[model samples]
Target: MPQSRHLATELPGPRSRALMARKTSAVAGGVGTTVPVFAARAGGGIVEDVDGNRFVDLGSGIAVTTVGASNPAVVAAVQEQVAAFTHTCFMVTPYEPYVAVAEKLNEVTPGDHAKKTALFNSGAEAVENAVKIARHATGRDAVVVFDHAYHGRTNLTMAMTAKAMPYKSGFGPFAGEVYRAPMSYPFRDPEGMTGEQAAARAIAVIEAQVGADQVACVVIEPVQGEGGFIEPAPGFLPALAAWCRQSGALFVADEVQTGVARTGDWFACDREGVVPDLVVVAKGVAGGMPLSAVTGRAELVDAVHTGGLGGTYGGNPVACAAALAALDSVERDGLLQRARAVEALVTGRLHALAARDSRVGDVRGRGAMLAVELVGADGLTPDPALAAAVAGAAKAQGVIVLTCGTHGNVLRFLPPLTISDELLHDAFDVLDAAFAATSTTTASAR
Candidate 1:
C-alpha cells in the first residue's frame, strides 16, 4: 500500500536470508553470494523486497531493464506473445517478431549504407557471431581487443576479454588468434598522451604485431563498460575506424552496455559520427528479456554461408516482442533525451564531489553511463579499498550502487532511462550522504 520508497531493515532482511539459503542448494557453485534481498515485485523505478522494503533501482538489473522494471508496454507485449506462442526458435520455423526486430535494427543503427542483422540470445553471442561474420568476410583469423574490456563469459568471448579474476582465471585453452592492445585510458596512460596520440599508438601496435592483413576484425567498446566507464578520447574511435577502412579489417563496436539509449545517444559510436562495420547490441535491447543482435554491414554479414549463422533460441518470439516494445518505449517516451538529462545531473554532482575530495580522482562517462574513479591524493594511485568501502557503505544506507573496472576502483552508475527526475535527485542525495559518511578528511586537510 506504500507509494514512497522505504527500507524497513538493513538490506537482505531475515526473510531474504532464509530464501538465499534455499537458493544456494539449488544453484551453481560459482554463483556470487546474493545481496540478501528478495523482490516481491518491481515497477517503474522501484523494487519492493519481500520484507516490504522498497528501494530505488539504480543498477537496472545490470543495465538491462532500461525501460524500468515491469514496464507496461513491455509486459503487455510479453503477455500477448506468450498467449500466441512462446518459442518457435527462428532456426526451427521462424516468426514475424524476429524479422521485424531485425528490420528495426537496420533502420535505426548508424550508417546510411546497406546493413543486415542477426539475432542472438545474449551480448556475448552477438559479439562472437560478429567476429564470425568478419572472419568469413575477410578470410582472416586474428582479432584485436582492448585491455580491461569485458566482452562475455563464453569460451571465445572469455578469450577476447582482458580481465583475469572471475572471467578467465581457471578457464584455459581459450579461443586462439585473439590479441590484446592498450585502450585509450587517458586517466592512467603513461605521459598524458592526447587522445589522437593514444589512438595512433594502439593502431601502430595492431599494425606491427598482428599485421592487419591477418586480422579479421578489431573489436572495442565505444565506452568501455566493465573496463571502467572510460570514454574513448576525442578522435580515438574515428581514427580507428579510418585505419580499419584502410587496412580492410572489420571494425566492430561492442555496445552491449552503451546501446539502446543507455548512453545519451542511440549508440556511443554514433555520437562521434563513426559508423562501425558491425555493432553488437544487447542488455537493455529487450527490456530485460534476453535478446541480442549483430547489426552489420550488409556485404560482410551476407558473406557467411546460409547455415553459418543462427541458434535455436537466438530470436525467441517473446524476446523479439519485448525488443519491439522496448524500442517503442525509447522513442515514444523520448528516453534518449531523458538519458542526457541524467548525465547532466550525475556529472554535475560528481564534479562537485570530486572538487572537495582528492579521492574522487575523475568523473567521466557519456549520457547516463557515468562513473567515479577513486584514487589517492596523488590522483595517480588507484584506491580500490576506499571504493569498496564507499560502495559497501552506500548499500548499508539502502542505496544500490555497483563497482566495476580492472582495478575495481570505479563505481559506475547505470540507472534506468525511464527513472523519474525526483528519484534521480534522491539517489544523488543518498550518494552525497554516503560520500560524507565515508570521508575522513578533505583534499586540503590532508
Candidate 2:
C-alpha cells in the first residue's frame, strides 16, 4: 500500500482505547506500547491502527522492519515456509534455510576473513552466546563494554548494558565479569578531543582497571540504539579493534540496530573498515521476524564446544526464509542507497531544527537510523521532559516518533527504507509543529 499519514480520529480512537483496556487486563505492565493504537496493517511507511489511523512509521517496529512491514517478498517467503514446515528444530533435523541464512550472514557481515555464523531467537541471545564463545576462545573472563551502551535485557546483557532505569531497574543480581569503559561521545567529550584520543582514554580505563590481558572481548554498538544514537567519533572503533588484536581479546560489534543496510552499509562497522572478530546482529535482520545471529571469525566461533551453542528456536525455518527475502530486498531494491537517501533527507531537516532550536542539542546517527538529542538552556543538561513532550505530540499528530537514551531525552528516528519522501516530509511537518508548540509551552512555564 502507498505510504501516507492520516488520522481519521483523535489519537487512540475509541476502538483502540477499548483494546488498550483489554490489554491492561490481560497483559503485563512491563510490555509497553509507545502508542495505544494497535496496528491493523502496515505497508510502505504507514502503520494503520485498528481505528483507521495511518501513522508514518518512524520507529519501524523499533528498527526491525527495514524492508518495510509488509514487503511482498518477505510475506510470500514466510507463507511458503510456514506451509512446508514450521519447525523440526534445526538441531534435531537441521534445515536448508538455516544454512542459507548462515551463509548469507558470513558473506555480508564485515571482514573477508573466513567466518562462521550462529543464528538465534533475539539480539540478546546472540550477544550472550557471542560472549560465551569469546570467553571460551580467548580463555579470558573479563568483558569490556562502553558507557551509554545497551546490549540487551538478559542477566548477562543487563550487566553489560550501562543504563539503569527502564532496562535495569529491579532487574538485579546481574552476571559478573562485565566491566564498563568510557565511550567516545564527541557531543559530551571535552573540547577538541579527537576520536583517537577518546579511544585511547577508553583503552586506558580497560588497561588500568580491567587489565587488557584478562579481557575476552570489547563489545560495542557501532551506533548506539537505546543509549541514544551515539556515533563514536571517527577512528574510535578501529583503535578498539586494534587494541583487541594486540591484547588477544575479540572485537565484537553489537550491530543489532545498525546492521543489515540500516546504516547504508551491510554493517555500521563497514563504514570505517573496522571489522570485528564477532558481529552480533538482530533487529532488521529478518524483516520483522524474530531472528538474530553471531557472525564472525570461523576459528573463534568454532573454538566453542560442539554442543556449546544454539537454542531450540534459534534459527526457525520460517524466520530464515523471511531473512532470505529481506536480504534479497536489500540488494535488489538498493536499500543501502535508500538508507543513505533517508540519512540525507532526515539529517538535513534535523540539523536545520537544531540550528534554530537550542533544545535540539545534537543531531547524530547514520542512514535511516538518526536522532535529535534534547537538552536544557545550558545545552548540556538533558531535557527528557521536552523530548517526551515532542514525541507524545508527534504521535498524536500521526507521526510515530520514539524516545530513547539513558536520560530518555533522545528522539530517535528509524523509518523504513521503503518510505516515500513525501511521507517523510509530512512526518517532519508534524515534528516541526510539535517542536514549536512544546517550545512555546516550556517558554510559558519559564
Candidate 3:
C-alpha cells in the first residue's frame, strides 16, 4: 500500500493475465505493449497493476508524463475544462484555452523572434505540418533527415525516420523527397572526427544528393530520442542550423521527447544556442494529455494561407487546459533543475557500471534523457540480447525500464521529473542488479 514498489504477486498475476487475454482479443496485433501487467493506478514514480504489484516507473510513458502521470494540477485543469465544455471543434467554435496554449508555446519556445504556434494531436501530426509549412514557404520539394532518427510512425514521418524493421519495413512506398544524412554519433564516429568535420560530411552529402536549394527543411531531433538517446556531438547541431540558414532551408527541431524540461532545458537546441526555424513539440507538453504543436518564425508559419493548418481535434480544449497547467507546473516546480539532477544521478551510476561491465559500451544523453548502450565482449559489437536481458530482469524485479536504438542495444531511462531522489536511486538499484545478473548469466552460457 506504500508509494514505493511492493509486489504482492508475480508480474502479470491472475488478474493481469485475465486482462491480457481480453486485450489480445480486443486490441490489434500491431499495437505493442512493454509490460504484461495492466495499470490500475499510477502516480509519482510508481504504477500499481491490477493484481496489487507496484513498479518504479523509469520510462515515464516514453517521456510523456514529465510532471508525473497523475499530477494534481493537470487533473484539476482537465476537470475544470470538462465541466465547462469538452469539445466544440476549435475550427468551428474556437476557445480561449487553445489560444492560450498556443500563446504559451510561443512565449516559452526558444528565440525572441516573432513566433506563431499551431497545435496537433500527436508528434507525427506536428512534424507533418512543420514539413508542409517549410515546403510551402520555400517552394521546395525535398525534406532532409538524419540517420538513426525517429520522427514518428505516419507515412511522412516513417519516411523521415531512418530505422527499418518495426517502423519502416513492410510499410513501403513511403513519402518521397525525404533524404537521409549521416548523424554525428560521438561514440561510433571515426576516431578523430570532430563535430565540425561530421557536420561537413553530412553537408557535403546533402549538397550533392539533395540540392540545398531544392530542400524544404532539414528536420532533426536535437537529441535523438527513440534512436538510442543519441546526443549529437557538441558542434553538430550548430553547424547544421547554420548551413540550413545559408542554404535557405529551414532547420526543424523535433523536440517531442526532449522538450518541456525533459533535457534540463526548454529544448535540446538551447544547450548549444541553436535556435531552429521550426520546433515540433509534444509528449511532455500536456502532462500526458494528447497534444502536440509546431512553433516557429511567424513569417514562415503564416506563409500558409488561412484554413491551411488546423484540425478538428488539433487543440482540444481539455488538452489545452492540461497543457497550460502542465507548463505552469514545469516552471513552478522547477522541473528543469530536477531533470539535471536526474542526469547526474543516472549517468554517474551508469559510468561506474560501464567500468565494471564490458557489455556497457557507452553512456550518453542530457538531463533526464539518458541511455546506456550494450555491447558484446569485443566492446564494439552491439549486444541487443544483453540489453533485452537487462530490461527484462529489471521488469521482473518491479522496476519499469525501456530499451531503444536502431540496434535495440540501448537501455533508456526517462523517469518523471517529479520522481523523488529516493525512488530514482531505488530504480537504479534494480537496474544495477539486473545488469549484474544478466552479465553472470551470459558469461555462464558462453
lDDT of 2 by residue, 165-194 (tens): 888999899999999999999899999998
Residue clash pairs of candidate 2 = none
The worst-scoring run of ten residues by lDDT in candidate 2 lies at 437-446
Q: Superposing all C-alpha atoms, what RMSD in Å does each candidate have to the true structure? A: 1.5, 2.1, 2.1
Candidate 2 Cα outliers beyond 4 Å, as residue runs: 441-446
TM-score of 1: 0.97
Query: For candidate 3, what is the TM-score?
Result: 0.98
Tell me the lDDT of model 2 at 133. Answer: 93
- Cα lDDT tens digits, model 3, 1-446, are 35597889977799999999999999999988999999999998789999999999999999999999889999999999999999999899999999999899999898999999999999999999999999999999899999999999999999999889799899889999999999999989998888899999999999999898899999999999888999888899999999999999999999999999999998888999999999999999999899999999999999999999999899999999999999999999999999999999989888877777777888999899999998877778998898899999999989999999999999999999989888888888998898888765333211
Computed on alpha carbons, the lDDT of every model, listed in order, comes to 0.88, 0.93, 0.92
Instruction: Work out the TM-score per prediction.
Output: 0.97, 0.98, 0.98
Error of 3 at 230 (Å): 0.5
* Candidate 1 collision pairs: 12-36
What's the true lDDT of residue 243 in model 1? 90
